[model samples]
Target: MKQPWIHNAKTDWWFILSPPFLVLLIIFVFQKQIQGLENHYSFYTWLFLIVFVDVAHVYSTLFKTYFVKAEVQRRKLLYLGMPVISWCLGIALFQFGALTFWSVLALIAVFHFIRQQYGFMRIYARFEPDNWSKKIDEVAIYTATVFPMLYWFKTPRAFTWFVNNEFDWLKNLPDYIGVITVLYILIVTVWIIKTIVEIIKTKTVNIPKTALITGTYLSWYFGIIYY
Candidate 1:
């Protein structure tokens, strides 16, 4: 039995992920026009704009429940602020001409950190043991950090495979039993398996729901890889 508020929240969030309309409009109508110009704007500037727009879309999801009450309003504002601040930092990194891929990776790491931290806080507020939350936090932090670094440095081909499906870098790997790409795939496979097992053991459907949402947003990337 879903709460009415929860139902409304999900409905409102659908607007954020409505790719066929809003996302396509942004990509085609706005970005394509901008790309044709011979302006001084670097690729990083356009990437920053894209990321800011994404943050804005996510922020819009809070409006579904924002006006309900004072407490809810405050929490919604704070929740929205986290991603905004992170995106602002990412924009700063872009201005400094940091590697676009690494900057994006760092932004994702921060986003996941905030989400996992919020989950830990909520669980602790329910009187869960501090040790339990600590363990979860450590695992989440390590996984987030290691995965991004692996993709950025050692297994750039796997990272491309994760995103664009082009594996030109794979041909350059040493023909060894323990190549970095192979190791990265093994690590990610194990992580996914462990995550699914934990979700089942805890009987927590929210974990799977989060995964599904992530998969939905990355569907294009998966399509490129799998197809």
Candidate 2:
């Protein structure tokens, strides 16, 4: 029997088109005011950074595949170090007042690396079959999507639109929305940690997977705690 989550060709096409559709929806909804936001980075720069990162990600995935087969630890090191290195680079860029668009893109890249590492671990765990690891992987995927969106929404410039516009839909919302949102995030975070501990107990020394998960945890923990 086919997997419940797997889709056929036509369904896949719809799934592929959904993101662009949603983006257009967002743009259309905010069209009147979105133009006012400062966007200094040119389209060429955006395209170049996207292509560069895509190449890097493809190379990393290939390297990971080889390392997993050879039982090498070097890929683990790269997996763990990438987010920390990206975070440091992001901070340096911010300090230098480099291109805001590129800085944000770099931060997103760091997030993508973390997501990929966690996803790799999840796929590996499936090869070996561990419920706890699977659960933790699910949590990581959810947080990877949620946290980045939250961060983007909280960015000073991004938040300005909400502050300046009196949209009837959001105008009467509670002033403590941020606090409430954070509390919910914290609760989910605690759940993720608990699931991770369960995973550790089940597979204590799956080195590559361990390194990936540990790196992801450290990246998010330190990224938030210290920054």
Query: Largest lDDT belongs to which candidate?
Result: 2
Q: What's the true lDDT of residue 65 in model 1?
A: 56
Off by over 4 Å in 1: 1-150, 153-183, 212-227
lDDT of 1 by residue, 1-227 (tens): 22112234555346432442354455545665654541556556545755576456666766665655765766876767877998888777668544554546645754664464345334423433456533543344344334443344333332231235233344466654246446545645555565577667877534323433333324332322222
| TM-scores of all predicted structures | 0.33, 0.35
Per residue, candidate 2 scores C-alpha lDDT tens digits across 85-172 of 9888778766754455354564465567656656555654555565754675566645644454444334432322212432222334
lDDT for model 2: 0.50
lDDT for model 1, please. 0.46
List the global CA lDDT of all models.
0.46, 0.50
Model 2: how far residue 130 lies from native, Å: 5.2
How far out, in Å, is residue 129 in model 1?
A: 5.2
